[model samples]
Target: MEKYIDIIKNSYSGYWRYLKHEIISVNHWDNYFYGLIIISVLVWVLEIIFPWRKDQAIFRKDFWLDTFYMFFNFFLLNLIILIALSNTVAAFFNDILAKIGLSISSFQLFDVDDLPKVLGLFVFFIVSDFVQWNTHRLLHRVPFLWNFHKVHHSVKEMGFAAHLRYHWMEPVVYKSLLYIPIAIIGGFDAQDVAIVHFFNITIGHLNHANLGWDYGILKYVFNNPKMHIWHHAKALPKHVRYGVNFGLTLSIWDYIFKTDYIPHSGKDITLGFEGDENFPKQFLAQELYPLNLNDKKK
Candidate 1:
């Protein structure tokens, strides 16, 4: 009990310290706080200058809502709830593993640290993106998970900020699945590879933005706005039932696996699911949406 309490306390304290550093300190290139602001503003400016959906308002419907989700999911939620909770859970998991005498400390399949810096970063990026791709598919394929994922798909007007407008449970699902595979690639420094993280965020922002761009020849390699808009289309293709275009960062996975589907331009396509009109519009309600056991009990 004391150990758990210590873990919670440490998590809260650590989160505050990190948050303070991100706020008061200005590291320009390596700072996520500033990176988020800079990237968001840049993309938003692009949207204003060249919006594919010309009729959509500057402050589009649910624009503020999505912005709130961006900040909430990225920063506040960690401080308020998840940081401590995750630490406690992780501690418990480690204890269980210890009791079983199964050590994950040496789980690395190959040490990326031994390779050249660029090659190591490349390998780490590909493997991590692949993990996320599979996790994104699971969010669509699993019914219960889809309930939480609905918050993201509820977007009627796609924008840059809409990239982060997802249920908090999503990171939990994503990071939980991402842990082991990353552990397998020994000597992974998140700070050292912050560029890759930011790059993915940029791609995610573009994918959700109201822009029509498929990197021509590179369309098969990278996910672009044109290909991703269909992922949110109200109607799914007849051939693909679960969902399509499940790529998070790279389109390569979807193309290789045949999950990629962009039958039309998708610029004016209706976004959201069949019963989205009834989905919660507010942040708090959406956070609690998937776990609404009251509806299930009925």
Candidate 2:
């Protein structure tokens, strides 16, 4: 019991320390709080300067809502709930592993410790992105998961801040699945791949922004706004029921798996699911809506 109390105390302390470091005394370029702000402002400026949807307002529909979501999912939610829960879960899992005479470092697909730092980052990037890609598909295909993901699809406007406007449960889903392969290739922590993390944040923001840049020939490799807009289209191709363009940071997966779909320019397509009109518009309502989905279905 006291162990759990200590966990909560530590989690809160860590959260406060990070908040102060990120906001009050910003000292690092790579700190997520500052980095998120920098990348978001950068992409938003690009959107304003060269927007694909010229008629769209500078402060598009739900702009403030999405902005709140950005900070909530990135920081505030951790302070409220996730940090304590995650710490408890990790501690429990570690205890179970200890009972079995195994630790996280027990399994290794290969040793990345000796590899060049750049190459190691590359390897982690590839593996983790693939995990996220698969996880993204599951969010669509799984009914229970889709309910939670509906918070994100509720976005009617595309903007840089919309990139992080997802249900708080999403990180739980993503990190849970990403753990297996990452542990298998153990040698570095998330901090060690800060470059990849920031790069993905940039691409994610760019993918959701109201910009049409496709990286020209490199569209085959990285995700771009033109391609990703289709992923959010209100209508899906009849033959494909679940979703399309399941790529998180890379478009290569969609192309390779034949899930890529861009019948034409999707700049003007209506975005959201079939029943998004009934979805909650308020943040707290959206956060709680998924919990009631099964009850509604019954």
Off by over 4 Å in 2: 189-191, 294-298
lDDT (tens digit, per residue) of candidate 1 on 48-164:
999999999989998999889888888898998788877787678778878988655657788888889899999989999999999999998888888889999999989999999
What are the clash counts of all predictions, listed in order? Answer: 0, 0
What is the C-alpha lDDT profile of model 2 across 152-188, one tens digit per residue?
A: 8989989888999999999988887877688888768
TM-score of each: 0.95, 0.95
Candidate 2 backbone collisions, by pair:
none
Q: What C-alpha lDDT values do all the predictions have?
A: 0.88, 0.89
Q: After superposition, how far is residue 115 of candidate 1 from its true place, in Å?
A: 1.8
**Highest lDDT: which candidate?**
2
lDDT, model 1: 0.88
Scored against the true structure, residue 183 in model 2 reaches a CA lDDT of 80
